[model samples]
Target chain A: MQASLFVSCIVDQFFPEVGESTVRVLRRLGVDVDFPPGQTCCGQPAFNSGFWNEAKPLARRLLRQLEGKEHVVVPSGSCASMLRVFYAELLRDEPAALHAAKELAPRVYELSEFIVDVLKVTDASEIGGRPRREPEKVTYHEGCHLRRELGAVTQARALIGSAPGAELVEMEQPDVCCGFGGLFSVKYPDISGAMLADKIDDIRRTGAGAVAACDSSCLMQIGGGLRAQGLPIRTVHLAQLLDEAATPG
Target chain B: MEATTKQFTQSAAKTLSDARIQDSLRGLYGGFSKARERAAEATPGWEEMRTRAQAVKSHTIANLDYYLEQVEARVTESGGNVFFAQDGEAASRYILDLAERESVKRVIKGKSMLSEEMDLNRLLAGAGVEVTETDLGEYLIQLAGDTPYHIIAPAIHMSKNRAAELLHRGVGAEGREWDTAELTAEARRQLRDKFIEADMGITGANFVVAETGTLVLVTNEGNGRMCTSMPRIHVAVMGMEKVAPTLEDMSMFLRLLTRSATGQRLSAYVTTVDGPRGPGDEDGPEQFHLVVVDNGRSRILADPHMREALNCIRCGACLNACPVYRKVGGHAYGWVYSGPIGAIVTPMLTNLPDSRDLPYASSLCGACREACPVRIDIPRMLLHLRRELAEGRNKNAPVAEAALMKVWRLSVSNSGTLAAANLIGRALRWPLLLLGRLLPPFSRWARYRELPRPVSPFRSRWKDIFRT
Candidate 1:
């Protein structure tokens, strides 16, 4: 089966390796993947900022680029949710595009959503370094958009559990937002930091070696605080782990 | 004062950081959040009730003008005077003139955010009218000379120990370590004399029923009833948006409000009073006046994205469910109305420059939407306000932020560059990784969190597998 891989802009610009890991993991599962070069963003920032007028053109352009695709997958839950929910709202004035938006939404899936529901690959990946360190106990911070909006929490954890030596532990209110709403961070830094501080404390309380989430933006925000404190705790996108699991040690 | 969003937030930040106030807000966030969650679970049709309640509020707000007239006519016929004050100054002036005419020197008040918005206590105090707050929370906050942090629980930021100290100092009973009951007794002993001696008692109405010309006041404390009935002259200051189309509509809201607010089957007191006391009535006000203050609601009513905010029941359920509020608490909002409703109202009611900063206070997590009884799309409103801030609609935001968003808006609109960047992202993976470590903001991002490192070219691998 052919799949269109959407390396969400956040992953593409800052964390290109996530894009590579997604492709490797998908290919290992025998899924044919194509990175549609025409894709840039899902137009979430504009849509979330209430610039429906500005976001609509981008949404239309996005819909047009991936128009004929049967399966489109993204590593980020928020970008997927934008396509699932806000894309249609943005294009409301253009009734002609409604069919395209509706048709594209269900077919648009997050990484775990695609792997578990579509690919159904449930084995561990034999990655490099002879396990590197000890069997690391990691907890997942379920990004709000992915968990609450996209309902990708369980699916994300299931994929994590498929990795060898990666014991996925559940953090309390794993779905609570880590205060990274794109512009919300810079706009209200104090409140954002305060909220992130709470999330970090919750993650630390679980005594997990690292925090993993599907959205790079959320990871970036949570990771910033954890890194600032110089804690042993690290943050990674789930795609990286699953890709590592797929490789031979 | 034309309070812009900036001033509101600055003041709020100052208040939130105050050690004494922050200590009090700990209970406000924890206690209410736990209580509301438990209440929702116990109520069988909690979700259904919320849906129905939202529908009712939406319908009333949509046809607000008709309901306002209906309520006015009913109140007048019931022997009560209904005055529509276009704004706060007008509302305060009307109340002050009424008091002057009635020779009212002493005034008592029940918990009312609307009165606080109008600064009625200050206005009445300036006129040499001694006004006393009847609710225990309101009384403490009043003595402290501060505005309420939370809408429902006025002194929610106050600790019992702090309250004991504030009361001991205010009432001239120095050095007395008072318990909760003792604190209540002190408030009662002091307010009792004012409640009886005062010529007028001012209270805020929970809802104004258009069908029966009735004003309902729901409270855990019985002070609302006493303040309304004990005085010879009664004046209820309510925001114009508080009107419901009918008694049934009022009933639907009351159930959702209390359950969502404090996890109670019903508040301890729900009093519905219409007009003056009848000849046979035992104890009630003889002259009743209801001042409907618009303040800035009419402007909010004009904005399609924001008008639903006026439907808020002042139930702080959204506050309890909000993660942001839980962390910083209500004082962070820096207004009489805090939590999700404050995020919407403070900016809408105040000018864009001063109050708009309050809207950016949320993470737009939509928890407020789930907890809202009227189902006010608070996250949506916050986003809209954010847009306004981004677009330079807010008079208070820094010019630098606006310029940056303009650049951001321009860059995202074009696909060719964005696509090129997408491909470049796969190509320049090494340098970008270095950039993430070296850059100031990126360093900030990496400090608490880690961005995933992409292994190889997503586009080229896909091309080899799919298109080939």
Candidate 2:
């Protein structure tokens, strides 16, 4: 099977390791991974910020980039949702972009979803992850768009739960947002910070070695908070957590 | 009563600093939210029920004028007065004029958010009528001189000791230590008298069944019934959109309402008042006046995008489900309604330009949409309000923001512009980290999280990185 990577603008620019892990995991599963060059952002930040007009062009660009790919894997849930769910809404006025988005949506997948649903890799070890030197604790933070928009609630957890190298601590309200809501984190910093504090507290209570999630934006938020709190916990993407770089054994 | 929604950020900041309120707010998830989840899970075909209810509400709202006229005819036939109040002032005028004519000196209330919307208590007191809030939560908050911290749990932000202190001070009780039970008992005792002595009772309508001309109030406390049955004159005010087409439709609404509001199969009292005392009625109010309030609802109903907001049952399931509401609590919303619903309702009902910050208060996490029984897409409404703000359809359209978003639009209009922008971003990344802390909006983000340094744009390294 072939999967064209849509390295969402965040994974593309700020978190290349996440993109690398995603590619490696797909490759290890005997699925050919291809990076479509013209791919840029799925235009979520603007789309979410109510600048749908600003977002529509980017959505058009992406739909053009992956019009006929067999599978388009996005590392970020928010970006994937933009392609899979919101692109149609953003491009409804333009008949051509709208049609292309509708055609391309079923092909688009968040990484964990592609692995579990499309690739049918139920266990982490099947995709290059081996038992670690010691068991590491990892809790999954369900990204809102990933869990709610894509409705892939248990795929990430199932993969993590089945990882022999790691123990899933299952933090309280794992589905709660980490409050890195694009411009929201900046717009309402106090409320965002308070929510982030609660999320950090939940992660701390689990005593997890790392917090795993599909989207880099959430990982960035959690990772930054952990670093700020002077905690040693790692924030691993679902792809990174399943990759050999994070696999100890 | 006055719209202070403009102070949302400052109020939210204040709420965040207060540890006590924060601790209290945290309980909403476990107490109300989880219970709602359990109730929905336990119910058979909860999703289908929500869908069916949404369809009924949508139909009822679309043909609201027809149902409303049906209601007016039936109500008038039953010898009850029906007043179409254009706004809060009109509602107040009708009620106050009725109060003067009836020589009403005491007024008792059921838990009515519309009462808050109308500023009824202050206006009545100013008219020299003794107005007492009959709902325990409403009474305590009124006594403490605080607005509702929540729709259902009016005093949720107030600690037990604080509630006791305020109640003792306001109720003119002897200063002493009090627990929840004793304080509740005292409030009951005080309000019990007001219910009996009151000449007029004012309540909010939960749902008005048009087929039967029935006005309903769903309350956990029995005060709603007391207010309805005990007074000589009973007045119910409601937003014009809350009409259920039939008693069967109302039953479906009842099923959705209690479960959504407090996770109960049924509240303690479901008081359905059809009209004033009938010819042979044993015990009920002598006179009934149904004041149907518009208060900007017509404007909302005309707008296709925002009309869904009127479908809100005021169940407050959205408030419990909101992360932003959980953090900031109700007062920060700066209006009668709060949380995700308030964010849209306040701006539209009051004035968008006045309550501009309310729309921007959320992270658009969408928990509210999931929790809404009628499925009001709150995030979509917020986004619409944001777009309106961005467009500056109203006078105060933050023009500065338009310039920045335009630049952002230009930068990411295509792959090449974005890549070029990325180059510029890389050069300025470090400077952003430093200057970001000093700036207004960037500082909001950088103050909390350590900004990641920009790496080489992925396209720049794609060929080398992808080669095996």
Q: DockQ of all candidates, in order?
A: 0.38, 0.66
lDDT (tens digit, per residue) of candidate 2 on B430-462: 787788778877777766777777787666676
Q: Model 1: per-residue lDDT, tens digit, B184-297?
A: 887788778887798999999999999999999999889889888998999998898898788988887888888878888799999999899988888799999999989999
Highest-TM-score candidate: 2
Where model 1 places Cα greater than 4 Å from the true spot, the runs are: A24-31, A49-56, A94-99, A115-136, A151-154, A157-168, A241-249, B1-4, B12-29, B170-178, B327-332, B392-399, B406-468
Q: CA lDDT of B191 in candidate 1? A: 79
Cα displacement (Å) at residue B206, model 2: 0.6
Instruction: Record all residue pairs in model 2 with backbone atoms less than 3 Å apart, i.e. clashing.
Output: none
| Model 1 chain B weakest lDDT span, ten residues long | B1-10
Top model number, DockQ: 2
Error of 1 at A133 (Å): 10
Docking class of 1: acceptable
Please write out the lDDT profile of model 1 over residues A136-195, one tens digit for every residue. Answer: 788998877786577665787876775767888887667667888886775656557767
